[model samples]
Target: MSTDEDLDRLIEILPKSIQHIIETHQYKQSLVEIVMDLGRRPEARFLTHPEYLSAKLISWQDLDYSTKRLSKFTDDNRAGIERTLHRISCIRNRQGLVIGLTCRVGRAMYGTINGIRDLLESGKSFLILGCPGVGKTTMVREIARVLANEMEKRVVIIDTSNEIAGDSDVPHFGIGRARRMQVSRTDLQHKVMIEAVENHMPEVIIIDEIGTELESSAAKTIAERGVQLIGTAHGNSLGSLVKNPVLSDLVGGVQHVIISDEEARRRGTQKSILERKGPPVFYSALELNDRFCWIVHEHVDRSVDMLLQGLEPRFQIRRFDPESRLSISLQKVDSSSTSSKGKAMKSNKNWRKNSRTPF
Candidate 1:
């Protein structure tokens, strides 16, 4: 029989359940293997009928555990099994497309894609946070691809561990048209960042796993120059990121962050900075709170630029202020706080309240 005939015969004889697995999961089993298994049963010879033969045997190594389990389902219960498989397949496909993954396994992956798109579209520096195995490196490479191909931006990747660029001794083929700077050590991260900016004239500089103090500082310098920066950090929550003085410094300026909860779960914790994007400002919540939270200003010392006293300031400090109004300067509490200062706002309840509204 032709291959198509074989497939049709198998689909017809098998219970609805097993057929469903084959259809949805794209399950393929070797005909020879099934024939061999059936040959062991002497009575199977009497069942020369193609329909009987197809129903009698099944084998596929590719199917996952659940799909494999469904293959053994009997005719009596096959309908219910098929329905279950069908539902899973639909949900998996839906999520895969939405999140940009081959299957549902790629949900976290798709988030990274969206995050990268955000960076390219918004032209902002960002961070991808995850301990490992949450597709951080893969996502970084894809970002490089999108930036280089679609946006036509000059992109450079600082591949430290070879994950982002792959291990071909040359830049991998998947990163689109970006340039690759393969570094054997992390010490070169800062130097590479600078070289990429000054020499390469890259519109976007991509790096993998920013860990050391030097690397962090270099990232800040690059961002300060107005060149877009993107990097990954190893941690679950934003708080953990702040713990590393250098990473905290580097991340302090990031405007948007995307996190992968799966990485946090794998590491027995619940945090990771999977993705970050910004215009070199707005790091974390506490950083934002300290720098620009709207609070009621019950008191203020005009002579000294400081909060006088009040029931916790109601108006948050704003990054900008009307030049004519009373000047309120908000300084970076730390290197991470975006330099959101003002000269026209002050410690006044009405002013603070009004400051929240962008003038």
Candidate 2:
């Protein structure tokens, strides 16, 4: 089915008044979220427009009409369409009464990351970093599908918020054959990561939101055991993550090292220097510039070292073409090709095309 048909399934849950208004959208496929706030006009949001879907202010009946068609809200005030990626987050008042809903449409946009297929196929653990809405979760899902269904690897997803997989017992078809391990609460992500390894015996463990020190330590444990790790961390760039003490372990935690005075002079640096303390839990990382582009650091240990030394790290610039075909450009530092880079992507051939995006 086309994306239009998928949009229909999501729109089906809205009240009749709002559904009539949404189906008229010229760019329904580009719709991002549908907003319905108590005592405010319902809206259908897209990439650029906040279009009013209904002229009338929403009432309790309107809200209930939509809620009745969906799953019950969880402790986190979130819900989703069964077996679909669309997410519905709730906004409650001080009394904990639902006041608004943000129904976010999720897509199984395949092939969006064809530009980074080489990185996915490399077999080393890699981390993706980007701001929200840049398709980190989307990319992770597609990679899980490729690894499990196509490459025949045993894969498991540590789905914390039900974003990686959909909100159902049956895993979304988008994930192919990969098994998913749902996290009951946010604080227990680290424990679940460990359990995924000890109990499941998966060849690859895909996780989302590596935010805490405990989670990063769990990631390190999994990587050390030679189980391939592919996940998203919270940082826009490698430099930001290194300074973030909680998440620094994903790129190999930083430490203060005391160098000999004589050695310091030889290196033309201060005696006290910061160095990566251990092998990075992730072999590489990619910084998403947008849905269509990313700046990649192919080597995690070397990238962290360069940042600690006050040297700008080189990057592999990747972009998707008008045809959704991926291309790679190497950004050289100091006019020398020998500078270190994020995954040194060689070419964009042999990327099997399926789905609408790499995400």
Candidate 3:
């Protein structure tokens, strides 16, 4: 999916001087994005390097040169090249004039779910969580493909921001035979999520970035209605997610219940305890610790219950073998206050940090 051809599509829209420097540079292979600000020299972001793409600062003419070639920016300040996975986002001034542009490189990367395909075959809903650039979008695209092409299931992708599919009227080939229902705007993503199920009659609904409480509740409804769901969200761990009031319901949520004095004494715990209010909306959750390693919770209900009880939950650590085979090891997660496992359980980072995302 990281093709020179697709990269060229985005490169074509850039000002000629900046584009020439990008194509001639050695960092072209590792390029992640191109930054063009009104008064700053154009910069190129790579996997391990951020360097200037051009010596001259970007001018109003250069900005207009790129903007005219791209599709009109939406309310979210996002525009994309037609039929390409690349994205162009604008930064506007106080008066609504474009001041900067973030040209993000989007690729239809495959093999993002090499270890999780079997879980998808189980027909249970799954929740994916990770920080930005953890390949969540890439994995969901591959999931839609596997469910549609190999298993022959009816799959619908509620593509908000056109992340899962390409930014075109038709979807990308990476989705295989799955149908895509594009949302008109980011705020209407939940409505499109519900609409895809009711109108299309899909066996599996593939969505990306379930951020808002309405979207989380909508996911619950879809799961309750017997549709297999696969999507990504913002939270890092089960404990952290259950603690977030906005996202807690995605994993059954939690509540403080005061137990009787006798029960508290018998249980050897405080009278006030946190307990799950209902069954988890999704039965399984996959947490990305980088791209190759994943921490998988097979049963969300059992795992959440264990976390609530100040106990460790069991998870399968799936890593790409050095010999190119699947290397799986069982790991237990201790959710008692201080925690450590991987990216999903990082104590230093804000695990419950919420971002306003549609996909």
Clashing pairs in 3: none
Report the C-alpha lDDT of model 1 over 1-359, residue by residue, as the tens digit: 23344344434433354455444432243221111121221111111221122333322222232344333322212211221111012112343311110111111112235412433677866665555434566567788888888889999988654446543355555677998885644567678778888888888898877788888778878878888887777865343453343565654422222336775555333242212232222121111222112211111112011211111222223332333222344432232221122212221223323524211
The prediction achieving the highest TM-score against the true structure is: 3
Report the C-alpha lDDT of model 2 over 1-359, residue by residue, as the tens digit: 44667678789988888887778878787888999999999988788777888679988888888888888887778888887888888898999888899999888877666777787788899999988777788889999998898889999999988887889988888888999998888889999999999999999999988888899999999999999999897667776777676887788876777889998888666677667888889988999757777888898788788766656566798887778777788874442332221111111111112221111
| Native-referenced Cα lDDT, model 1 | 0.44
lDDT of 1 at 44: 16
Could you give the candidate ranking by TM-score, starting with the highest? 3, 2, 1
In angstroms, give how far residue 206 of model 2 lies from its true place. 0.8
Global lDDT of each candidate: 0.44, 0.80, 0.82
In Å, residue 307's CA in model 3 sits off its true spot by 2.0
Candidate 1 vs. truth: CA RMSD? 20.0
> lDDT winner among the candidates?
3
The Cα error of candidate 3 at residue 272, in Å, is: 1.2
lDDT of 2 at 227: 95
How high is the lDDT of residue 73 in model 2? Answer: 84
For residue 195, model 1's alpha carbon misses the true position, in angstroms, by 1.6
Please give the clash total of every predicted structure, in order: 26, 11, 0
- Give the residue spans of candidate 2 off by over 4 A: 332-359
